[model samples]
Target chain A: MVKHCSVFRDKTELEQGVAKMAELRQRFKKVVLKDRTDYYNTELPSVLELGNMLDIAYSTLIGALAREESRGAHTRTDFPKRNDEKWMQHTLVTKKDDTFSLSYKDVSFTKYEPTERKY
Target chain B: MKIDLKIRRFNPTTKNGREPYYQAYSIEASEGMTVLEALMSIAAAQDPTLSFRRSCRSSICGSCAIKINGFTKLACSTQIIPEHEKAHEMVLEPIANHTVLKDLIVDFDPFWKKLDKVKPYLMPPETQPEGRTKEVHISEKDAEAIDHAQKCIMCGSCNSECNALEIEKKYLGPAALAKAWRFVGDVREEGGRKRLGRLSDDHGIWDCVRCVHCVEYCPKGVEPLTAIERLRSRAIQEGIKDNHGAKHVEAMVNSVKKVGRLDEAAMTFKTLGLLRSLGMIPFGLKMEMHGKMPHPHLFPQIKKIDEVRTIYAEIKRKNKNAKKKPKG
Candidate 1:
């Protein structure tokens, strides 16, 4: 799933990652927590956190697939240039139901306008 | 190379809930592979039930410190099998002087409790003039005193390995004391002698027996013992000499300076005073009966007693010169 998003995150790969994540999310329901005693039980917390992490991964993959631009970490081979008009905005993922909905918000800035990050 | 990794396992739900037992596993290791990696492999493939705390494969996180062959080390940084111990048996256990929460993870509550006693944060300056809200400058010498102490990652290696903490749990161990020094040495900190006064109390700065384990096992060379000594010296410099810690040191120093050796008879009187030392008469008689206690007035003169006074004079001269030096 990580490879699908990170390795070759074009439209096709990210779409596949989103699908894989959607499928994998259900399997967590079957995860039986071994350490029930809870004396510093890292297993229980980690498993519970995995659900949140999967949601984040799913959101990241969806956002990467939708934002077809070569911004910071989202490097799409198909669309290599930075998109300022449509894609230079925050992708807000809201989860009302089990499914997440993505919305766009304008990048708020005045003095330091969005430009290529120079070291 | 395959070496036997004996991990100490503990679970409250187990049949013998109170008894902790070691479970040995043969794990494959290579050159430069860390003890954390070995434990990771063991937990991953051999036994998924194995429990340990680990984060950030690098030593920066300070989470993966455990006993590697009875020595406290950050497992992430320490190699699996050290060169000296090539005979194949590598024991992995929880850090000492802490309760084991699981297999290799010790509960850090006791440690954090002591650490919290010494206010770990830099207390805000007493006054920040409203007009001047700029960064304050500290001399390099001031920063240098605290540079080594500030490097402490609070890995609890020093706390776990501390011999003093083993005896008295309340003795705020070396890690916390070093952290105390971190703030106390800061020229900008306004707390100043007030913090030292708190630390000079019972089970504080004076409680440290100078075991030096904290110095040896500190993954970063924080030299917590040195920090404790610095705190002690600072405590003395501030003329906070009424405390037992200072008095004991003063008594010893006076005895050595006078007789070129510790005069237990006179030193005890100086340290505790004649009135307070009344309680120690019984113990003193036992020593006196054994001919161990020197007569207070008829002191046996050591050879070259003036040599001891010379060292004391030199230190006093240096201290005078140091005071004369300009401050930032």
Candidate 2:
């Protein structure tokens, strides 16, 4: 229930962003209530609202998806294992013309050697 | 079980360009085989040149801390089989936020330097007796506090995970602050002010962004964030309000105490002390532009302010009770 205002260049862009977020929220609510699944199970929206309800471009989604294992706050019950080799790299999600792409970034091996992650 | 151990190695004397590179070695792991055991086997069988530090094989003597997989943990403590499910690969490297001395070894000088800055020793009120010093009696409650502090084995795991250290290199990370709290909370310590004063520097207590990374990473359950918060409260109570960061903390506390929630606009204004303080005016305007500015009239109220007050009061009461309880 967080709300924020963004200065849109034109009404159309603002409308597009709001509409997209509304649709995304509806899909999210549906998944939470009925499907018992997350956004990853279905098609991701072009816009994602983060923090105190500011519309973020869908660029962050690919990175989120690339992380197959659930760690920290990023929980994916379906994929509930830490896959180090495939998913160790940091996922970078970029946006270009209403589309999103996912890329992996290698973790700095200088200090921390990733070991058996146990809480 | 066979486990592939990938260890990062660096040789200082041998080559001009001895960049860090990974060396994978196969090791047989038993049911209770710790990462340290596997490492020891590798050193014994394959590579004697491999270097790392480990004193107490148990978690106590924090010398064997390193990054395993992607997290910081003591090699002596971490069991290997749980980490290796399918591929059976274990990546071992030095602790983060430090220069690697060699393979799996990091320079601990910087970490110890931060520890030294906090004056990590208790200074009691009365001097000890001549020749034979009397053991200062500590109650169960005070002993609990001391125990929490003493749990820190100086592993530097929290330091490696600290976000403040990532941004501000000079910032005194969690381990030192927790060490500072170990002294500050000690009822025997007569010079609490001196300890508080030491943490009042630029790269000291004020620089913490409250990221809670230290709290998350500390294996000892020592909440360094809580320690930092307690230190802030003590600092404020002692009337040490010179720095901008201290002033901001005070203002936030005041706002939270008065109103149930923080008045962000008021906090920003009070923190700067004036409308036209250098760089503040435009920053304030920029927030306003971004619609991030909170309206003073629209102070967000917590529904159960009394509940919060009661919780805080109960905590204070418990602390008082603990302090008053006689030593056994």
Number of the top-ranking candidate, with lDDT as the measure: 1
How does the DockQ of candidate 2 come out?
A: 0.01
Clashing pairs in 2: A113-B67, A113-B68, A114-B68, A114-B69, A114-B70, A115-B68, A115-B69, A115-B70
Q: Determine the iRMS, in angstroms, of model 2.
A: 22.7
lDDT by residue for model 2 (B1-328), tens: 7777888877564463178888879988899899898887776557656777877898888889898887788888888898777335688888889987666778889999989989888887666545535566777877786466668889999889887888888999889998998899886777888778778778888888898877777777888888888788788767888877788987887677677778887777777777435557677688889987678788867787887777768987997897687533
Question: TM-score for each prediction?
Answer: 0.82, 0.65
Question: How big is the positional error of residue B17 in model 2, measured in Å on the Cα after superposition?
Answer: 6.1
Q: What TM-score results for chain B in every one of the models?
A: 0.90, 0.85
Superposed on all Cα atoms, model 2 deviates from the true structure by an RMSD in Å of 27.2
Interface RMSD of 1: 2.2
- The CAPRI-style docking tier of model 2 reads incorrect
Query: Between which residue pairs do clashes occur in model 1?
Result: none
Q: Tens digit of lDDT per residue, candidate 1, span B1-328?
A: 8777778988876676458999889877898888898887876567767788888989888998998888899999988667326634688889999988778888899888988999998975678846655676787877898999999988899999999999998899999999999999986777868999999989999999998999999999999999999999999988888877799888888788877777777777878877878988888789889986667777777999888789889999999998897544
Model 2 lDDT per residue over A1-119, tens place: 12211221223343454556656645654432221223221112212223113224333333444456665555545566667777767777665754556777888887778775577
Candidate 1 regions off by >4 Å? A11-23, A117-119, B44-48, B83-87, B123-136, B255-315, B324-328
